[model samples]
Every structure is written in structure tokens, then in C-alpha cells.
Target: MSSMKDAREATFIGRRTDGTRIRRPLSPHLQVYDMVQITSGLSVLNRATGIAWTVGSAFLVWWLMAAASGPQALAKAQWFFSSFLGILVLAGMTAVAWFHTFAGIRHLMWDAGHGFDLPSTWKTGKAVMVATGVATVLTWLIALISW
Candidate 1:
């Protein structure tokens, strides 16, 4: 009786009382992790930029289609793109694009078995960040000047 009581008191980890084993959340808390700032932060930023780039590309395609449709459609698209809010959004998209491009090149270097050492890895990561910022600024500056 004591043994049976103990068994009943203990947690039965797998399966329900009805006997079908299935996956379920066994705990209320989520699994958390700590990512390295220089490395993991860059990786996460890269992924985010990639997603942003895809969305930006879709918008660009829409703009192109608008142009192809007719002059009225093109004018509407241009008006939206020239608005203050639109310019801000375009700036953000440009920054994300630069960051993604630089990070991608860094990843390619990694694939080529370069910059694998801790020191080189950190250096390259920092370089990629600086390059992204510089590229973004230069791109915006050129756009403003040309316009």
C-alpha cells in the first residue's frame, strides 16, 4: 500500500493516465539561452536583415509592377515613396540591406574556412558592423546628392 501510494505521489513523466504517449509541455517555464554578444548578436542581426530584405524586395517588385501598369499607378507609387514616412522606411530598409550584404560576405568567408579563430572572428564581426554603417550612410548620402 505504501509503495502504491508512493508511485501515485511520484510524477509520471511519459504518457497520460489513459496510456497514449504523446508530446506535451511538461513545464510552465520556457527554455532560455544566453547568446554571445559579438558572435550571436551578429548572427541574429543577419537573420533579421535577411527577412527585412525579402520584404523590401517584395515592395520593390510591387513598385515595379505599379510602374508597368500605367502613369497614374507610377505617380501614386512615387508619391508614397517620396513621403516623409516612406523616406524613413526606405532608409531603414537600406541600412538593413547593407548589414545583410556585409554579414553575408562574412559568412562566405567563414564558409571558406577563414576568420574562424576567436580573435579574427571578433575582428571580422566588428568590421562587418562598421562596414554596414558606413555603407548605409554612403548610400543615403549618394541618394540625397544625386536627387
Candidate 2:
């Protein structure tokens, strides 16, 4: 039992004044620390928007299935989709889509050896954000105007 304790202690790098052992920090421990860079935040947003876009695409499939089912099903789908809450969800989905698209472009630029510097990285991240916002808003505006 004493040897077991020694082994555990040896594994840890240090102990605090309160006698709590500290171990090596693991990757992706975002909750334990503050993010100081725009790049990190943009990276997180890129991943999150990707996930959201995938989930939102399910709604597209649902509408397509509804269309194939017949007029009644299509009518119900249209009604729900035209509702206020549905409009809000659609707006959110639109934003996520544009954000993910812009972020992916930014990544492709990086892969092509562009925007690797700190200032360029931050600028591109901000550009992606602003472009996503403008694109989403313009999409909704055109949709509403056409409707």
C-alpha cells in the first residue's frame, strides 16, 4: 500500500500547499482556462458552426420527405416552416451555414499558405465573422422580399 502511494506520487509533477497533487495538463481543457486569442475563438466557432450546419441539414431532409409524401404533408411542412419560430430557426441555420462556409474558405486559404501571421489570422477571422453575418442577413432579406 505504501509503495502504491509512492508510485502515484511519483507520477504527479508536484503537490500544492494544500497537498493536492498536480498532473500534466491535457489537451482541450478549455473550461479550465481563458482563451486569449481570436484564432482560438474562431477555431471553436468553426467547429461549432459545422456541427450546427449538419444538424440543420436534417430539417432540409424533413422538408424534402414531406414534399415527396404529397400535398397534405407538404402543406403542413410549409405551415410550420413559415411560422415565426421556424423563421427564427431558419435564420439561425442560415447564419451557421454562412459562418461555416466562410470559415472553411479561411481554412483553405491557410492550407494554401495564406494568413498564417498573427495579424492576418485575426483579420481573416474577423472577416469571416462579418462576411457570414452580412451573407446571412442578405439571404433573409432576399427571401423575405421575394416571398
Candidate 3:
């Protein structure tokens, strides 16, 4: 047990010229990594959008429940939804929904053995971003014009 402990310690630590022990990092750290690239950034965004969509769905459920409860509840819900902050939240949720949809489609393509290469990954990432933006903007434009 003592020999094993020494072996582990020797492998993990180094002695400097002045006899000081220096510990080596156990794994690669963020500081050594390059700036976020499109592939990785989009992957993270995809996960974030998924969570945001789930939360947005909860809000939808609340709105539905409010409508089912009473006229007062429905009115309050409608007023909140029509407020500026609520509109901002709705717009963000819209973007999240679109982004999650596009990212899911991208993942389905990957599962089908497409976009495995670096260039294709980047292309698909950019495509998902653009599609999400366009869809979100168009959705809001239509809603506003109809209103």
C-alpha cells in the first residue's frame, strides 16, 4: 500500500530543482482551450434552448389553466401576456422553440450519418442559427401584422 501510494504520488507530482513539489493538472482546463467554435457553441445553445422551451411550455400550461379557471383569471393572464416584459419573454421563448427545433433536426441528420465532418458541422450549425432567426422573426412579424 505504501509502495502504491509512492508510485501514485511520483506520477502526479514533480520535484523542482530547489526540492519543491509541484502538482500536475489532472486534466485539460478551459484556459488551454481555444475560443468557442461554431460547432461547440451551437451544441451548447441547443441544450440551453431545450431547457428554455420546457420552461416556456410551463408558461403555456399556466395560461391554459388561467383560461379554464375563470374570467378574472383569464383577464389577468391576458393582461400579463400582452405586457412589454411578457412580450419579450414570449419572443425569447419563440426563438428558443425555433432554435431547439432546428438543432433537433441537425442532430437527426447527424444520427443518420450526415454532417460528421468539420466543415459540414459548421455549415449545419450556421444553417440552424439562420433558420431559427428567420423563423422567429417571421413568426413575430406575422403575429404583429395580424394583430
In candidate 1, what are the lDDT values of residues 20-122, reduced to their tens digit?
7544444542245346579888988999899989988877987999989999998898898889988987999999998998999999999999989999989
Runs in model 3 deviating more than 4 A are 1-26
Clashing residue pairs in candidate 2, if any? Answer: none
Name the candidate that leads on TM-score: 2
TM-score of each: 0.76, 0.79, 0.78
Relative to the true structure, candidate 1 reaches a TM of: 0.76
Output the lDDT of residue 33, model 2.
53
> Candidate 2 — which residues are off by over 4 angstroms?
1-28
What's the candidate order when arranged by decreasing TM-score? 2, 3, 1
Query: What is the model-wide C-alpha lDDT for candidate 3?
Result: 0.86
Predicted candidate 2 versus true structure: per-residue lDDT over 11-91, tens digit per residue: 546667899767644456677556656788888888899899889899899999999999999999889889998888899
Cα deviation at 28, candidate 3, in Å, is 2.5
Instruction: Give the lowest summed-lDDT range of ten residues in model 2.
Output: 1-10
Residue 2 in candidate 1, Cα distance off native in Å: 27
